[model samples]
Target: MAAPALGAQEAAAAAHMLSLPAEAFGNDPNVEMVWAVKAYQHAQVYFNLISSVDPKFLKLTKADDQIYSDFRKRFSDLKIDVLDSEDMKSGPAKEKWRPFCLQFDGVVEDFNYGTLLRLDCSRGYTEENTVFATRIQFFAIEIARNREGYNSVVYDSAKEANLGTEVVSSG
Candidate 1:
């Protein structure tokens, strides 16, 4: 395959980064720059992993139900609760859920709060979003989400934005 044009690659990277909140980093410029780089690295890792499986998958369709089913099974095998309805409704169950959920600690410091929060704020964390899931779960949900139609809108918008700036050379 031919290499992506430099402008196209930069545009794509810029588009991917638009998900981050600028104001969140307003308190510290150095920290903000660090997080931006970390977030970009994390996103690159994810995109590479997903693309390796099937480059056209995201543009085509969502994975089958079995893919998501297997995701749940993996979570169970890892002893992480799926946080089912009954689990959510009970105080004890909710309390038990903390350990299973992803936490920012020693193991996660490489990614750190700046990067993790970027992913969480945009794609994970909420009930409706996939980021609330642990790393494996997050990957699973995002793979499925991209395959489905959900992620197409962002790219479409990105394309439009890129077009508007194609005339100017940032370099």
Candidate 2:
């Protein structure tokens, strides 16, 4: 069967994600940047095929055998690794910080794949003194066929907000 068409919202979301600045997501180390690109490419392919079949099934059972095979090969080539997530804390004089480092060592099946990383930090002190909470998210996707490609980064982030709502974000 042929795939269904993308609605207006879906189209717009895809466009937005491609527009976000690489720095806005805090990928300064370079390797992580590459992972982002790879993930985006993988996602694009699945997005295009949404009309064809459910992506969840595609990822697990190889519902889209060709796409699955291609993904496996490409993913194997890109040897992605989390290099570091160092906690930076100083005594009275030093500022506190946490930095995450990652490395991408592999070839992307196509220029379409990319990734997104998000880091959030919150601070709180107990009555006696010291405790803080930090949360980090490293989201990556392999965009296969993004009509707008990287230009849709901003839209993609916005669309992601709709997750669990009316719109759903694809891997």
Candidate 3:
């Protein structure tokens, strides 16, 4: 059977992220950029595993792209667009930094045994002042029967040992 449409729970999660206090994420240099990269990588790995076992879990659409685009737009709004990989690495600036979008193409089965699209973001990195930091960001949305959807909880290197319940919600 065809996969179900995106559901309220998924929407709520997305909205919750949008409503988060930006200050919660500090720009401390010790934050270890690797955390972001690891989170995205783990999310992608989970997507791959789920898609291989069941092809009815996640589904991607034009709207999915729009969601990503909107998130990217926030960088511009924050006046940090210059920090964006796309704008920072060009022409003479190519030697300094570069940004990349994560890409994934896959399918998975949902709890109800329906097919869904798996949208993923891969690893991206930038080099500045001879220092390189990797930033990876991605999301997996599983669409089940009855038009319900939920996202996979992403874990980072920091949470690896503890296997804690904290979910990485952003790139």
Candidate 4:
């Protein structure tokens, strides 16, 4: 965003922006800047929704073959970490996630593309917690978090914040 850009909104005027600056994305060739930006933005939106809105009322996909329930059942059998660390995604650990990632083929957009993911469920994304991973890796972990009640802290904290706001207003 710091780069000079056209004020014009026209496609012809903005044709130069079809690809973003490489420096902004650390020049990861496998991950296009556009895809990474959109993926990150969507991830932020998803976190916001799960934090502000109850997960039970959420709908992720448009009437897939019970993907949510299916994911939970399938993921339950894995003996690996619950998508909490970068160790499980590299070298030998990849075996656990590679097949897992394959299961979500056609289920998630750009499942194999690189993405940023958080290490802890109790906290939002931060430099310390963020990890470079496949899009499927991010979803596989987060979806598991949502179903297993690990993301409850986000919702619970939101409720407490709202209550504090109400108390201040009443006072």
- Which sections of candidate 3 miss by over 4 Å? 1-25, 57-141, 144-171
Number of residue pairs clashing in candidate 4, backbone atoms closer than 3 angstroms, sequence gap of 3 or more or interchain: 0
* Ten residues in sequence with the least summed lDDT for candidate 2: 117-126
Candidate 2 C-alpha lDDT tens digits along 148-170:
14324433444554554554444
Leading candidate by lDDT:
4
Candidate 1 CA-lDDT value: 0.41
Q: Tens digit of lDDT per residue, candidate 4, span 1-171?
A: 121232445334333443555465575554454455555665677778988987555656552335445655655664323344645555766776577678777867656767677777777766776678886666656666666677777889988989999999999
Task: Give all candidates' CA lDDT scores.
Answer: 0.41, 0.31, 0.32, 0.63
Consecutive 10-residue window with the lowest summed lDDT within model 4: 1-10
Show model 1 residue runs off by greater than 4 Å.
1-40, 44-66, 69-132, 167-171
lDDT of 1 by residue, 1-171 (tens): 122233667656555554567675567665545445545566555544443443225432133344445545544433221223433225874465444333323433221232221132123223332222234334344544555444444455555666667856563
Q: Native-vs-model 2 lDDT?
A: 0.31
Task: In model 2, state the lDDT of residue 84.
Answer: 20
List TM-scores for all candidates, in order: 0.34, 0.21, 0.22, 0.67
Kindly give the stretch of ten consecutive residues in candidate 3 with the minimal lDDT sum. Answer: 107-116
TM-score of model 4 relative to the true fold? Answer: 0.67
